[model samples]
Target: MTTQQTFARRVFLVAGIYGIAALLPQYFMEAQVGRDFPPPISHPEYFYGFIGVALAWQLAFLLIAGDVRRYRLFMLPAVVEKLTWGLATLALYAQGRLAVFVVGFGLIDLTLAAFFLYAFHSTRAERG
Candidate 1:
């Protein structure tokens, strides 16, 4: 209904989606790491580590979304991080050199990050 609530919901949804998606890479990495799988089969460790980081990032937002005010300190950093990733993804996509699915998902993330930033600023201003 309200802008704040909508933003919170969006954050939760994005975080949850990304968190779940991160797990899939682990399976792929496991299956192809040491076997005669593919060229990208030598770095399962790094992929697993990245999945861990993604999981943490997503869980943080999921935890904070319910009480954004209590976790206000994290808002700016989260927005900045997401925006940076989104822009990089967009740039890669624009060059016609990125995974199409990744690029499309990044576009959605970019939009959500922008909206979150706007909502955060507006809420802060209102409070001030």
Candidate 2:
């Protein structure tokens, strides 16, 4: 594999691993998060649903990591996924609706989004 593809593979792999590590605990931390973040979760469904969908995307990231050339197309939505959460969180923080600490995760997502974009562009010569 070329250096670019290697970079993409590593990026996705790390993202997937990191996402799983971060999200999996939330399943059991609903109460703690509510206490720490304030305003107890009023809707359990939405909370778990978000975790489920996010967890699925993490799996998708791992899948893409397994085959960067073949799954290059998926990089697009992956970027979107990062951006949606990152931008929304940052926006909320800007509006004073979210804690400053949460901005760290948002920034991480945005950074990863940039890497994902670069990875996608870097593999343009690869066979789809």
lDDT of 1 by residue, 49-68 (tens): 76677677777777667666
What number of backbone clashes does candidate 1 have, counting pairs of residues 3 or more apart or in separate chains?
0
Error of 1 at 120 (Å): 1.2
lDDT of each: 0.67, 0.97
TM-score of each: 0.70, 0.98
Evaluated against the true structure, the overall lDDT of model 2 is: 0.97
> In candidate 1, which residue pairs get closer than 3 Å at backbone N, Cα or C atoms, i.e. clash?
none
Candidate RMSDs in order: 3.7, 0.7
User: Candidate 2: minimum summed lDDT over ten consecutive residues — where?
Assistant: 119-128
- Candidate 2 clash figure, as a count: 0
